[model samples]
Target: MQITVKLFATFREGRFKQADRDYPIGTTVANVVDDLAIVPSEIGMIFVKGRAAEMDYVLKENDALALFPLLGGG
Candidate 1:
């Protein structure tokens, strides 16, 4: 299945802002993050198809995913 991944903030540094990737059926959000070399601790939020999703959320074909890194600063 093919899915779109959108990166935000620092997450886009040295990486693309968006991409279309192919993964096997039943692939989870965590798998994509790992493939992108993003650690779980750096993830602030995940959205799948515009809805908040967990790392264990299964990715569906043509799904759109957005990843945001943890924000800091007072």
Candidate 2:
């Protein structure tokens, strides 16, 4: 399956802003995060096709997955 991943905030520091990547049919959001070397604790929000999604949410072909990093402000 091909998934489009979008990274936000600090998540794109050393990674791309968006890209289409291939994964197995049973791949989940957590799997993609792990593959990108992102710590789970650093994730602030997740969206699949513009809807809120969980880490264990299974990805489907052509799904748009967005990941946001934890934000801090004083």
Least well predicted 10-residue stretch by lDDT in candidate 1? 65-74
Candidate 1's clash total is 0
Candidate 2, residue 38: the lDDT equals: 97
lDDT of 2 by residue, 1-74 (tens): 89999999989999999999999999999999999999999899999999999999999999999999877689
Give the Cα lDDT of each candidate.
Answer: 0.95, 0.95
TM-score, candidate number 1: 0.92
Query: lDDT tens digits, residues 1-66, model 1?
Result: 999999999999999999999999999999999999998998998999889999999999999999
Q: In TM-score terms, which candidate is top?
A: 2
Model 1 residue runs over 4 Å out of place are 72-74
TM-score of candidate 2 versus the correct structure, residues matched by position: 0.93
